[model samples]
Target chain A: MPIIINLDQVLADRNMKSKELAEIVGITEANLSILKSGKAKAVRFSTLEAICEALDCQPGDILAFSSPNPSQGGESN
Target chain B: MNLNTFFKRLIDLAFYLMVPIVVFFPGTILYVLMFPEQTIINVNIPYVENGFSGKALLFSMGFFALFLLFFAGLYQMRKFAGLLLKNKLFSQEVVKRTHKTGTFFTACALGSLIFIGINSLFSYEGKISVTFGSSNFNLLLFLLIVGVLFLLLSDAFKKALAIKEENDLTV
Candidate 1:
C-alpha cells in the first residue's frame, strides 16, 4: 500500500493513451488498468522496462513510495 | 510415472466412480421401497407382526430421507472431484461445492442421531434413558467428526480462493 503507481501522470505527460501504451507494452488493457489503478501486487522488470520504453520515462517516474500510515510522516495519497 | 499425474488420474477415477455410486444407490433404494418383501433390505430389521403399520411407514420414510441425504453428500463429493480433476482448485465453484458437501454430511450426522434417539424412545417399553456406546452412536460420532473436518476444509478453501483471486487480479 505504500507504493503508488504514477502511470496515469506519465501517460498524460507523454500524451499517450492507456490502450496505446498497453498495445506497445504487449499487455492487455485490463492489466494496464490494474497498473493505472495502483492495484498491482508487483510489476515484473520486463513489464516495467516495456512501460518505460513505451512512455520514454524512468521507473522512478512510473512508481513512487510513500508511507501509508499517518504516523510514518509520509504522504499516502 | 509422475506423482502429480498419478494423483490426477486417481481423482479422475474417483470422479467417475461417484457417478455410478450416486446413480446405483438411489436406484437400489427405489427398487427396495417398491418391492420391500422381495428385497433383503428389511431382512435385518424386524417387521411388525401386524404388518407395515403407521409407525413402520414413518420409520421407512425417515430412512428414505436419510438415504437421500447420504446420496446428496456423495453428489457434492462428485462435484468436488470433478473440479479437482479439471484443476479448478481455487475457484468459487469449488469452494461452494466443498461447503455443500460439508453441510450435507453434517445434516446426515444430526439426522441419524435424531432418528436413533426417536426410535429408541418409541421402542422402549418403560422409563426412558439415553443409550450410550451403541453402534449407531459411534457411527453418528464418526460422521460428526468427519463433517466438522470438511467444514473446516471448506473455510480454508474459501480463504485460499480469495487470496488466489486477489493475486490473479493484481496483474
Candidate 2:
C-alpha cells in the first residue's frame, strides 16, 4: 500500500490514453485500471517493463514510495 | 463419458436421493410414533412400566434431535458437492458449508454421548454400563474425528482463499 502507482501521471505526461497503453502492453483494460487505481496486490516485472516501454519512461516514473505514517519516523516504542 | 460429466451425474443422483431422505425420514419417524401398533417395529423401553412411557418418548425425541443434526450435516455435504461440481471449491460458501457440516457431526457425536449417559441413568437395573466396544460407539467416535478434520479443513480453505484473492489482485 505504501508503494504508489503514478501510472496516470506518466500516461498524462506521455499524452496517451489508458486503452492505448493497455493495447501496447498486452493486458486487459480491467487490469490496467486495477494498476492505475492502486488496487493491485503486485505488478509483475514483465508488466512493469512493458508499461515502461509503452510510455517511453523509467519504472521510477510510474512507481513512488510514500510513507503511510510519515510523522511516526525512525523510532519505535 | 468424461470424468467431469460422470461426476456431475453422480453428484446429481446423490443430491436427488438425499432430498427425499432429508424430507421423509422425520415424517416416517413421526408416523411410527403416532401409530406404534400399526408399524412392524415395536417401540419399547426396557424395564419401563408402559411400552411408550414419558421417559421412552423423551429418549425417542432425543434420538430424533440427534438424527436431525446428522441430517443437517448431510445437507451441508450435499451443498458442498454441488459447489464442487460447479468448480467453486475455494469459495467462501464451500468453506461455510464444510464448517457447518463439521459442527453438525461434532454435535451429533456429543449428543449421542449425552443420550447414552441419560439412558444409563434412567435404566431400572442398578448397574451403570457404558460400552466402548459397541458399533454405535465406534461410529460416533468416527463422526467426531471426521467433524474435527472438516473444521480443520475449513480453516485451511479460509487461508487458501485469502491467498488466492491476493494472487488474483496481483495481475
Candidate 3:
C-alpha cells in the first residue's frame, strides 16, 4: 500500500479519458479502474508498457512510493 | 462422456442417493424406538439384557446425534461439489461450505469418542478395557482421521482462494 498509482494525474496531464486509454491499452474498463484506484496487487510489465505507450509517459509518471510511517525512519533492528 | 461430465453425473447421483438416506435415517430410528423387538439395528451392548433399556437408548440417541452431524457434513460436501461443478472453485462460498463440512465431521468424530467413553463406563462397570479389535472402534478411528484430513483440506482451500483473489486483483 506504500506504493501509489498516479494514473489519474498522468491521464489528466495527457488530456485523455480513462475509456480512451483502456481502448488503446487493450484492457477492460474494470481492470483500468482497479489500477487507477490502487486496488491492484500487481501490474504486468506488458500492461505497464502498454499504458506508457498509450499515455506517452514514463512508468515513473504513473507510479510513486510514499513512506507509510515516515516518522519511524528506514532503520530496522 | 468426458471426465468432467462423468464427475458431474457422479456427484449428482451421490447427492440424490444421500438425500433419501438422510431422510430415511430418522424414520428408521423412530421405528427402532417404537418396536424394539422388530428393530433392524442390533446394538449389542454387553450386560444390557434388554435392547430398549435406558443405557441402550442413551447410546442409540448419542449415536443418532453424531450420525446427524455426519449427514450435515455430507450436505456441505454436496454443496461444495455443486460449486465445483459450476466452476466457482475459488469463491468464498466454496471455502465457507468446505470449512463447515470439516467442522461437522470433526465434531461428529469427537462426539463419537465421547459416546464410546460413556458407553464403556456402563458396559465395563468401572473396569477400563482397551479393545482395538472392534469394528465400531475402527469405524470411529477412520472417521476421526477423515475429519482431520477434511480440516486440513479446508485450510489448503482457504490459502488457494487467497492466492486466487490476489491474482484476480493483479492488473
Candidate 4:
C-alpha cells in the first residue's frame, strides 16, 4: 500500500493522453487505466521499459514509496 | 458427432444418470425407515426397533454424508464440464467448486471411519455378526487418499487462480 504510482502526474508532465501513451507502449487503454489508478499488483520490467520509452520518464518518476505509518517505520529489530 | 459434442453428451448422460441415484437414495432410505418389511430396489432392509439408537444415528449420518459427497462431486463435475463448454478456465467459480468437492470427499472419508467404529460396536454387541472385510478397509483407504488428493488439487487450483488474478491485474 505504501508503493504509489504517479502515472497521472507523469502523463500531465509529458502533456500526453493515456490512450496515446497506451498506443505507444503497446498496451491496452484498460491496462493503462489500471496502472494510472494504481490498481496493478506488479509492473513487468519490459512494460516499465516500454512506458518509460514512450513517456520519456524514469521509473522513479512514476513509482514512489511513501510509508503509510511513517512513525512505525515497519522495521522490526 | 464431433468430439466436443460427444464429450458434452457423455457428461450430460452421466449427470442425468446420477440425478436419479441421488434422488432415489434419500427417498429409498425414507421408505425403508417407514416400511421396513416392504421390498424396494429388490432389497428389504430390516427395521431397527426401539427408535434410533446412537449407532443408528451415526450410521445414518455417515450414509447422508456419503450421499452428499456423491451429489457434490457430481455437481462439481457438471459445473466444470459446463465451464469447459463455455471456454472458461480461470474463474472463482471453478476454485470454489473444487474446494467444495474436496471438503465433501473429506467429510465422506470421516463418515466412513465412523461407520467402521460403529460396525465394531455392533459386532461386539452381537446385534450383527458381520466382520469388517479387507475390501471395506481398502475402500476406506481409497476414499481417504482420494479426499486428500482432491484437497491438494483445490489448493493448487486456488494458487493458480491467484496467479491468474495477479497477472490479469498487472499492467
CA error at residue B58 for candidate 3, angstroms = 1.0
TM-score of chain B of each: 0.72, 0.76, 0.73, 0.68
lDDT of 4 at B72: 78
Docking class of 3: medium
The fraction of reference interface contacts (C-alpha pairs within 8 A across chains A and B) present in each candidate is 0.48, 0.70, 0.87, 0.96
Q: Candidates ranked by TM-score, best first?
A: 2, 3, 4, 1
User: Candidate 4: deviation at residue B103, Å?
Assistant: 1.1
DockQ list for all candidates: 0.40, 0.70, 0.75, 0.78
Ten residues in a row with the worst lDDT in model 4 chain B? Answer: B39-48
The digit string of per-residue lDDT tens for model 1 on B1-171 reads: 565456656756755665575556557655655775763655334344455456666776687677677667767876777677678888888888888888888899899999988888778778756657676788888887877787888899999987876777655
Give lDDT tens digits, candidate 2, residues B1-171.
666567657756766776786676567657666775664655454433554556666776787788788778877877877788788989999899989989998999989977876777767487655665656778888989988888998999899999998888876
Task: Tell me the lDDT of candidate 3.
Answer: 0.80
Q: List the residue pairs that clash in candidate 4.
A: none
Q: Which of candidates 1 and 3 reaches a greater TM-score?
A: 3
Tell me the docking grade of candidate 1: acceptable
Q: What is the C-alpha RMSD of each candidate to the true structure, in Å?
A: 6.6, 4.5, 4.9, 5.0
Q: lDDT of model 4 at residue B53?
A: 47
**Per-residue alpha-carbon lDDT of model 1 for A2-21, expressed as tens digits?**
88889888888989898899
**In model 2, what lDDT does residue B87 have?**
89
lDDT of 1: 0.77
